[model samples]
Target: MSFRSILHDMKEELGSISRKGFDVKLGHGFRSKSQRVVQDNFVVIDAFKQSCWANMPPELLRDVLMRIETSESTWPPRRNVVACAGVCRSWRETTKEIVKTPELSGKLTFPISVKQPGSRDTLIQCYIKRHRGSQTYYLFLGLSSASYDDGKFLLAAKKCRRPTCTDYIISMNPEYVSKGSSAYIGKLRSNFLGTKFTIYDTQPSNAGAKMTRSRSTRLVGSKQIAPRAPAGNYHVAHIAYELNVLGSRGPRKMQCVMDTIPASAIEPGGLAPTQTEFVNNNVDSFPSISFFRSKSIRVDNCQSEAIPIRKEGMLCLRNKAPRWHEQLQCWCLNFNGRVTVASVKNFQLVASREDGSEHESVILQFGKVGKDVFTMDYQYPISAFQAFAICLSSFDTKIACE
Candidate 1:
């Protein structure tokens, strides 16, 4: 055969092999230009697309998501539910519906911490919603005045390693006001276990600047009592504690007192006692008489037996009474303070009935609201100063004391 005819035959053979999907190598083991171009241009489009959860049937998808969203014990779901909403339109709508439910949307709960602005001053700010129907209450805890020269002072408890055994100081500013006078009002000290702590009346007497051993008031934890279901979503039953006034004489000496009356309990003819009146009545009930007592001497019908103090001076209540609120036309609990903006410690004031029913009307909750801030909600019957002081007591752990 001629050279041209041989070349033509070779070309035909190569073309036949190329059509069979075999890679043809040219000089230097490189693939043929035509074969390379054809391979580059050929795209493999998958007939089976990636599977997605969004394609799931609406009913089945909702069931699967409900398990995750409701898994959290908190009132409003926090993690997976919120994250799933951003993934798709269907997820967003489902999450919105779930969160809008009456139980979840009615209350607000948040975390809070204490911040000290100065060595003698502490500041706290938080938001609180009193009840389903009431407006949000803003709580602020700081110095009444920024001036340092004033001998009178309000302070936050300093962070203590041994909170139970050590005395927490709420010192007066300037250390010394008049000639040879020490600046100290009172100190709060807890039991060895921290289950109970007392605020002492340390203000110096007329004789001289001396620390008085007189106990102003005490708060005792109820860890030994039977646990009830939490009244609100963020709260557990463990936070229950009792407020006790120190007494001198008999079994009824120490009184379990509440400063604020529920708005429901106030009758048209009944008197609504002032916060000062309430405090004075409890304080005067103590055997020791002082000039601070008001001459009027108003009595409140809302006094309970002192929760018996243990051998260690720790008092725990067997039961708590709900306050009546005539305005809201329901039983309510007022967590507000007469002298302080918030309680010195964190506490819960639950509105429960005398019949021991499961229905809770209004829960006045005080707790950590945010970083360096605590929350107080409910009708504030007492002064902000007193409420702030009560909240200060709750900053440390009662169980661990650390």
Candidate 2:
């Protein structure tokens, strides 16, 4: 079908609407609202078309809003709702349900403020109090200042009573800073005294370089400057911990991640005894271990070689984002067991550079997208859970044709 004809057909499908109210068929050889409105009155169609989706139909708006709200999209529905509201009065009424309240969120860094000594509540004291009984939670707390006061950053000492906070993965935008103390970073160090969170600092230079001089020059490249060691330091509990989604913590309750013991797998969580070496030869594929089944894997921060373990009767790998050498088909699982599956999955690997350059990757030569359309950002292997779901959902697809 021609693009125009296909587009026309799609609209015909959309114009048939049964809203909560109007079954009023403004009809006659009228296939849909667009056609009736178009042939009848230029003035009316002009007005209706001008409205776009605003005055069209409440049912349609509800369906669209539901889809947008429930399904995934890069932009916030609030912003889109606001923009659509601006388009026409009907849109404003239809999209009035969009919530635009910005909550406490984003990568956290230091210099958090303490309320005045006599004041009833400071942001830090409030957050600490609210989080008193809390297990790991995903929350955003803001810093009141850009620099520290009297040589100390305020967030430096507000400790979480939960011992688990010590292991909490603290992630932040690399740009947060306290300007005055270039040499006196000791202030920030005190923040970790009572808790167990280790910092995973991202380099500012590593932030996407799509920028102008004004933005690029701001904060003097906050991502790059060497941070001063936090002051009043105690022993570092754990140097590195895996962070879950956007620095979210583990579930409020411990979530169990399960794995199936394939016949070839070795005893569960015991893979070192397996002797499957990393080889590129096409003889045997390394057994696939879905990260979903194994939520977190422990590995040495700095490891020399890939280690294997035997679980069930086969081998299970802890990390999947291996440095794959095509010549040597087997991958080099780098982390000892440190990276979270969510962290690896959520990794924003832009396949192209800011200037729009791309690496040459094997196309794999199949599927809907043309060669090399896949990358860490958009493509992923079939997850173990998905595979199991397919097996359950299928009657014919599961069994291969003889």
Tens digits of per-residue lDDT, candidate 2, 208-234, equal 212111111122222312233221111
lDDT of 1: 0.32
The lDDT per prediction is 0.32, 0.23
TM-score of 1: 0.29
Across 1-402, the per-residue lDDT of candidate 1 in tens digits comes to 533353354456555655666554442111122232334658642211111434557896677566655554242334344445543456556655554321223211111011111111111223322221221122333222321112111333342334225344443332321111222333444454444444433321112222322212221232211122111111001122432334322111111123223333322342222211101112222233342434232111011112233212111112224454678654333443322232234445433333434223222345443334445433322222233334444554544322
What lDDT score goes with residue 166 in model 1?
37
**Superposition error at 117 for model 1 (Å):** 26
Worst 10 residues of 2 by lDDT: 363-372
Model 2 RMSD in Å is: 26.2
| C-alpha lDDT of residue 380 in model 2 | 15
